[model samples]
Each structure stands twice: as structure tokens, then as C-alpha cells.
Target: MITFILRRLATGVAMLVTISITAFVLLNLGATDTARRLVGQTASAEIVARKAAELGLDRPLGERFFEWITAALTGDLGRSWQSGQSVVDAIATRLPVTLSLTIGAVIVSAALAIALGALAAGRRGWTDRVVQVLSVIGGAIPGFLIALILVLVFAISLRWFPATGYVRPEDSLGGWLATIALPVIALSIGAIGSVAQQVRGSMIDALRHDYVRTLRARGLPHHRVVYRHVLRNAAGPALSTLGLQFIVMFGGAVIVEQVFSLPGIGQSAVAATVVGDVPFVMGIVIVTAILVVIVNLAVDLLQGWLNPKVRLS
Candidate 1:
């Protein structure tokens, strides 16, 4: 297990390095003038040239990429060409918001998935049929649509929470949770659908295995057989699917953040890319890549732990 984990860590590092190179190649090799576009078209030619020089855009691509990667490793993600704010600091400021939204969505999705999935797996008749139908419909609808509907029903029609705006937890726990609640629900809807389907399928398969009957014949309590045996068997694939849902939610959070006027890494990335803020854009890209790689690694470790027969090394 330790060996497998070390290998995964190495793989994650390699993936991050590749992603950094790809992002840099896109930035410096693209036709856009990074400095001028970031500074604005109205800036004088002299100002553009000076800005480019100051930003090290005047250097060769190889040199610039090296410097950029070095600084990134050292926790200096460069200054935003527009705001002059450190890219790392800016992202750090927004990281909590994004994390909170994603975490909330994960919790909600996981709970819904486990419950609906187990129910559907455990029975036949209308309950199973209803869960299957709902899963299909929910999966067919995109997350942004869910966000719109939620805002309309819960925020606009009922006014249960603010339509827009975010609050820091440090200020008011209730306010902060209330602000993020709708966005979390919006992000989780599609995820719950996908995960529930996966769980239902996996659970059904696990329940049918010969060992399940053997356990049942041994007088094991139904709940014990389901929880101790069935869930552990089903969880490996469900966990992997859950990790993928996390990635999807990150993308969805970009639009949802904008819709709700919440400051988050996704929104920051969009703004940076729109303005050709190369450093900030690259910073966001690197961070996102790292996050994905770490998630995959974590999933592998978790699955391995769940089943002793599963071997990675």
C-alpha cells in the first residue's frame, strides 16, 4: 500500500509538471500579446513594451517557463498584470469559497446517492421505478439549469435565502451557510443523479454475489450484511465516480459562481483568461490540475483500502 501510494504521488507530480508546460505553451506561444491585452488596448506602445519587459515576456519562452515554474514551486504565483495582486494570494483568498461550495455539494450528493441507491437496490416495485426515473431525468438535466430552477423557486419565489452575494463564516456562520446553500444544491443535483445511478448498479451487483447469500444464510442481520459487506464492495466504484463528480462540479461552479455573484477560483480563472492575465490564468490552471491529480490518487488509495484483494503495486 505504501509503495502504491508513493507511485501515485510521483505520477501526480509528473501530471502537474505536464499541465504546467501545456499552460505555459498556450500562454507564450499564442498570438495574443499577453502584456498589451492585460494592460488594455489604450495603453501607449512604450507602456506596453515596458510592461512586457517588466513581466519577462521579453525573455525566451524556455527561460520564462523555467522562471515561472520555479516561482510557482516557491509559492510565488506571480502578480496579476491588471490588479498587481499576487496571483497566489488572490487565489488563496477565493479558495475557501470554492472549497466550501464543492464540499457542500459532495456531502449532499453523497447522502442522496447512498440513500436513493440503497433503496432502489433493496426493493422492487414503485420505489425502484421512481428512483430510476428520477435518476434519468436528473442526469439528463445540466447543473446550470438546476441552478436556475433552484434560484427561481427557492430564492426568487420563496425568498428563503439571498439571491446573490456571499458572506464569510468569520462574520456570521448562518449568513455564510445561507449564502452558499443554494449554490451547493445547484451543483449537487446532477452529481446526485450520476452517483446514485452508479451506486444503485454497483449495489445491485454486490447484493447478488454468492458471498452475499452465504452471509445471509449464516444468519447475519440484513443491515449488517448490507452495511458491512455490500457497501464496502460497492463503495470502490462509487468513490471513483464521486471523484469524477467533483471535477465536473468544479467546472459547473464557474457558471454557478457567476450566477450567484460568489468569488471563487473558477470565477477568478475566467476573469484572468478573459483579460490575458497569463500568470493568474496559469496559476489557476496549475492549482486545478493539482487538485484533480490529488483526487485521483486519493480515490485509488481509498479503493485499495476498502478491498484487501485489490492491489495497485
Candidate 2:
């Protein structure tokens, strides 16, 4: 187990390094005279040159990356070129909002998917057909479209949830939940469909195995056999699906945030990119990559726990 964990950590580190390098290169490649942008178009050529040199834009790409990465290791992600705000501090301020939405979405997705999947697999009639059809419709709808519909029904029309903005749990727990409810629902719909399908398939397969028959023959209750035994066996694939969906949720949050006007890292990211705030944008990339690594690592550990066979691989 120790070796497995160590190996996973090493792989995560390598992945982070590769992702950072790729993001850095892509951002730099299309960069258009950052110094000029900083000093303004009205600035003289010499002023632009001075600004470039001052900001180390004149330095080689490799040297700049080394300095940035070294500082990042110690938690210095640099300042936003536009706002002069510490990148780490800026992200810290808004990170909770995004985390609230995405994490809430994941939890809701997992719970609903497992229930729907188990029902569909065990019942295997109208219940199964209904779940299958709903899954397809859910998967077909885009998160942004879902967000729009949710806002219209739950926020604007029904007035159940807030239409826009975020409320920290620190401010008001009820407000926080109310604010995030719609966004979480929007982001979770597609994930629920995908994960439910995986869970249904895995559960069906597990139920057909000889072990299931043996458990039944032992006079175990139907619900107990299905929930405790079959469900556990089927969880591996559903977990993997959930893990992948978590990553995909981050991408979808950008559009959902826009639709709902939520104040999250997704909104901040869009603003940063629009103005070409490279330092801030790079900070977002690295932070997001770290999150992805952490989530994938957690999923791997969970999978290993659920199925010891996974640890061997």
C-alpha cells in the first residue's frame, strides 16, 4: 500500500510538471508584447523596453520558467499583472465559491446516480427503461443550458434559489446552500447521467456473477445482497466515472458561472484571460492542475481500498 501510494504521488508530480510546462509554453507563445500592454499603447518604444526588462520579459523562456517554478514551490505564485494583487491571495479569496459549487455537484451526482443505478439494475422493468431514457436526455443537455433553465425556473420564476452571486458559508449557511443549489444542479446533471449508466452496467454484471447466486442461496435478504455485496463489487467503475466527471465539472463551471453570474474562480479566470493576465492565468492553471491531481489521487486510493486488486496494478 505504501509503495502504491508513493508511486501514485510520483506520477502526480510528473503530471503537474508536464501540465505546467505546457500551459506556460502555450501562454507565452501567443503573448503579444506584455510590456507594451502593461505600459499602455501610448508609451514610447524605450518605455516598453524598460518595462519588459523590469518584468523580466527580456529573459529567456527557460530561465523565466525556472524562476517561476522555483518560487511556486515555496507558495509564491507572483502578482497579477493587471490588478497587482498577489495571485495566491486572489485565488484564495475566490476559491471557496468554485469549490463549493463543484464539490456540491460531485456529492449530489454520486448520491443520485447510485440510487438511480441501483434501482434500475435491481428492478429491471419500467424503472430500468425510465432511468435509461432520463440518462440519455440528461447527458444530451449542455450544462449552460441547464443553468439557464434552472435560473429561469428555480430562481426567476419560483424564487426558490438566488438568481446570481454567492454567499459564503461563513456569512449564512442557508444562504450559501440556496445560492449554490442551482449551479450545482446544472453542473451535476450530465455527470449523473454518465455515472448512473456506468453504475447500472457494473451492478448488472456483478449481479450475474456466481457469488451473487451463492449469496442469494445462503438465504440473505434481497436488499442486503444487492446493496452490500453487489453494490460494493460494482462501485469501482462508478467511482472512476465520478472521478473523471469531477475534472469535467471544472471546465463546465466556467460557462455555468457565466450563466448564473456566480462569483467563482471560473468568472475570475474568464476576466483574466480576456485581459491576458499571464501571471494570474498561470496561477489558475497550476492551482487547477494541483486540484486535478489531488482528486485523481483520492480516487485511486478509494479504488485500491474497494478492490485490493487495483493496488497491484
Candidate 3:
């Protein structure tokens, strides 16, 4: 298990490196002159050139990439052109909000997906049919639309919670939760559907396996057979799917954050892009990529643990 984990971690690091290079190249290619943007429209050409030179933007692409990578490795994500704040500090300040939203949404979505999936799999009649319909509806709705509807119903009409903005959980746990409740629901909508579908499918497949048949023939009770044996066996594939869903949600959070006006990494990234803050944009990309890689590696380790036969092979 340790060996497998180490291998997966190595692979994840390599993947992150590749992702960093790709993001760096793409952002540089698409970006306008960050120095010019920083100095503003009123700045003269000579002033702009001087500013660019001062920022080392006048250096070769290879040198610039090296500097960026070095700074990133040392946890210096560079300064934001707009706010003139350290990118690291800006991200650190906002990280908690995004993390809270993402974690809450994932937990809710995962629990709901597992329960609904298990019910649908075990019942396989009216319960299953209803869940399938609902899942389809959820899958069809975009997250932004869901956020809008949630805000309208829960925040505007019902007035149950704040429609926008975020509160630190530590400041006022109740208020913080209330403020983000709608956004979490919106973010988890599609994830619930996708995860439920995967879980239901995997559970059904597990039930059909020879081991489950053998357990049933051995006079195991129906509930135990389904919940203990079947669900556990089915979890391997479902977990992999869940990891992929996490990746999807991470990206989707950007749009949802905007709709909800949450101060998260996603919101920062969007703002940076709109104003051409190259360093901040690149930092977001790198952080997101690293997270995805780590999650994927964790999934691989989980799969190995769940199915020891693979490790032996």
C-alpha cells in the first residue's frame, strides 16, 4: 500500500509539472502586456517600456518561465497587478471561503448520492424510477441557473439566507453557513446527479457478481447482502467516479462563485482574467491543477486499498 501510494504521488507530481507548463505557455500566449495594464492607459510608451523592463517582462520567454516556476515553488505566487497585493496572500485570504464551499457541497452531494443510489439500486422499481428522473433533471440544469433559482426562491422570496457574499465560518458559524447554503446547493446539483448515476450503476453491477450470488445463497439477509457486501464491493468504481466528479465540481465552482458573489479562488481567478492579471491567473491555474492531481492520486490509492487483487497482480 505504501509503495502504491508513493508511486501515485510521484505520478501526481509529474502530472502537476506538465499542467504548470501547459498553463504557463497558454496564459502567456493569450495574455496582454501585464506591465502595460498595471501602469494604466495614461502611461506613455517609454514609461510602459520601462515598467515592463522593471518587471522583467522584457526578458526572454524561457527566463520568464523559469522565474515564475521558481517563485511558485517558493510559495511566492507574485504580486497582483490590480490590487498590488501579493498573489499568495490574496489566495490565502480567500482560500478558506472556497474550501468551505467546496467541502460542504462535496459532503452533501456525496452523502445524498450514496443514499439515493443505494435506495435506487436496492429497490429497483418505483424508487429507482423516481431517482432516475430526478437525476436526469438535475443533470440537465446548469449550475449557474440553479444558483439563480436558489437565490430567487430561498434568498429573495423566502428570505431564508443571504443571496450573495460570504462569511467566515469562524466569525459566525450559523451566519456563514446560512450565507453559503444556496451556493452549496447550487454547486452540488449536477454532482449529485452524476454521482448517483455512477453509484447506482456500480451497485447494480456488484450485485450481479458471483461473490454476491454466493453470499446470497449462503442465507445472508437481504439488507446485509445489499448494504454490506454489495455496496462495499461496488465502492471501488463509485469512488473513482466520485474523484472525477470532484474535479468537475472544482472547475464548476468558478461560475457558481460568480453567481453567488462568493469571495473564493474562483472569483479571484475570474477577476484576474477580466483585468489581465497574468500572475494571479497563472497562480489560480497552478493551484487548481495541483488540487486535481492530488485528488486523482488519492483516488488511485483508494482503489488499490479497496481491491487488493490489483496490487498483487
Candidate 4:
């Protein structure tokens, strides 16, 4: 297990390095006159040169990357060109806001999907048909559209959840939950559909296996036979898909944050990119890549643990 973790860590590092390099290259390639752009199109030559020196844009690519990596390793993500704040600090401040939405969405999506999927697989009448039809429709709808509908209904009409802005959990747990509930639902509605479909397919396949028949023949209760025997076997794939969906949720949060007027890494990232804030953009990219890699690694390790055959191979 230690070896496995070490290996995964190495892979994660390599992936991070690649991401950083790509971001750095793209940034440099587009911003050839970095200092000129930083100041303004009308800035004098001396001012441009001075800003260039301050930014170290004149340095060789290798040295710049080394310094950038060194700073990143120390969590000093440089200053945002746009806001003039420490990029790392900016992202850190917003991280929890985005995390709250993403984590809440994950919980809701997984629970809703698993219940619907399992029921659809186990039952053969209206319950099955309804789950199937809803999954299709839900998957077809964009998350932003879903979010708007939710805002219109829950926030504007019913006035159950806050229309915009995030409430700090420390201030009021109830308010925070209510504030986040709609966004979470909006973020997860599509995920619920996709995951449910995967689960339904996997469960149906698992039910046909000889082990399921053996469990049923032994007179195990219907729920146990389906949930314990079938669901467990099916979960490996479903969980893998869920991991990918978590990453998708992170990306989708950017657009959703805009619609809801929530201050988060997603919102910050967009502003940074729009203004050519290389340091901030690079910071966001590296953080996001690390998260994606870590989640995928966890899924791999989990699958190995759940299935001995996977570990063996």
C-alpha cells in the first residue's frame, strides 16, 4: 500500500509538472509583450521595460519555469496581475466556497442516483419506466438551464433558498444549507441522471450473474439480494463514473457560479483568464489538475480494494 501511494504521488507530480509547463508556455506564447499589456497599450517604452523587469518576463523560459515551480511548491502563487493580490491567497479564500457546492452536489447526486438506479433495476413497471425516462430528460438538459429553473422556482417564486451569494457556515448552519441547497441541486441534476443510468445497467448485469441466483436461492431477503449482492458488484463502475462526474462538477461550477453570483475559485478563474492574469490562471490550472488526478487515483485504489481481481491484475 505504501508503494502504491508513492507511485501514485509520483504520477501526480509528473502530471502537475506537465500542466504547469503547458500553462506557462501558452501564457508566454500569447503575451509576447507582457509588460506593455500589463501597463496599457499607451504606456511609454521605459515603463514597459520597467514592468517587464519587475515581472521577470525578460528571463529565459527555463529559469522562469524553475522560479514559478519553486514559488508554487512553497504555495506562493505570485500576485494576480489583475487584482494585485497573492494568487494563492485568492484561490485559498475561494476554495471552500466552491468545495461546499461541489461536495453537497456529490452527496445529493450519489444518493439520488443510487436509489433511483437500484429501484429501476429491481422493479419492472412504472418505477422502472419513470426512472428511465427521467434519466434521459435530465441528461439532455444543461446544468445552467436547470440552475435557472431552480432559481426561478425555489429562489424567486417559493423563496425557500437564497437567490444569490453564499452564507458562511460558521454564521448560520441553517442559512448556509438553505443558501447552498438550490445550487447543489442545480449542479447535480445532470449527474444524477448519468450515474443512475450507469447504475441501472450495471445492476441489471450483476443480477443475472450466478452469484446473484445463489444468494436468492438461499432465501435472502429481496433487498439484500439486490443491494448487497448486486449493488456492491455494480458499484465499482458506478463509483468510477462518479469520480469523473466530480471533476465535471468542478468545471461546471464556473458557469453555475456566474449565474448565482457566488464568489468562488470558478468566478475568480474566469476573471483572471479574461484579463490575462497568468499567475492566477496557472494557479487555478495546477490546483484543478491536482484535484482531478487525486480523485482518479482514489478511485483506482478503491476499485482495487473492492475487487481482489483488480488488485491482482
Which wins on lDDT, candidate 1 or candidate 3? 1
- Best candidate according to TM-score: 2
lDDT value for model 3: 0.83
Model 1: residues >4 Å from true position, as ranges?
43-46
- Go through the candidates in order and give each one's C-alpha lDDT: 0.87, 0.91, 0.83, 0.87
Task: Kindly report which residue pairs in candidate 3 clash with one another.
Answer: none
TM-score for each model: 0.95, 0.96, 0.94, 0.95
Worst lDDT run of 10 residues, candidate 1, spans: 29-38
Q: Over all chains combined, what TM-score does candidate 3 have? A: 0.94
Model 3 backbone overlap count: 0
Per-residue CA lDDT of candidate 3, range 189-232, in tens? 88898888888999999888899889989999989998887887
Candidate 2 lDDT over residue span 1-313, tens digit each: 9999999899999999999999988777644467777788899999988877777777889998999999999999999988999999999998887888899999999999999999999999999999999999999999999999999998999999889988888999999889899999999999999999999999999999999999999999999998999999899999999999999998788888888787788888988886677889999999898999899999999999999999998
Candidate 1 backbone collisions, by pair: none
Q: In terms of lDDT, which candidate is stronger, 3 or 4?
A: 4
Number of clashing pairs per prediction, in order: 0, 0, 0, 0
Residue range 165-248, candidate 4, lDDT tens digits:
888899999988988888899899989999999999999998989988898889999999988778988989899889999999
Any residue pairs clashing in model 2, and if so which? Answer: none
**Candidate 3 residue-wise lDDT at 119:** 91
* Model 1, TM vs. native: 0.95
Q: Tell me how candidate 2 scores on lDDT.
A: 0.91
Better of 2 and 4 by lDDT: 2
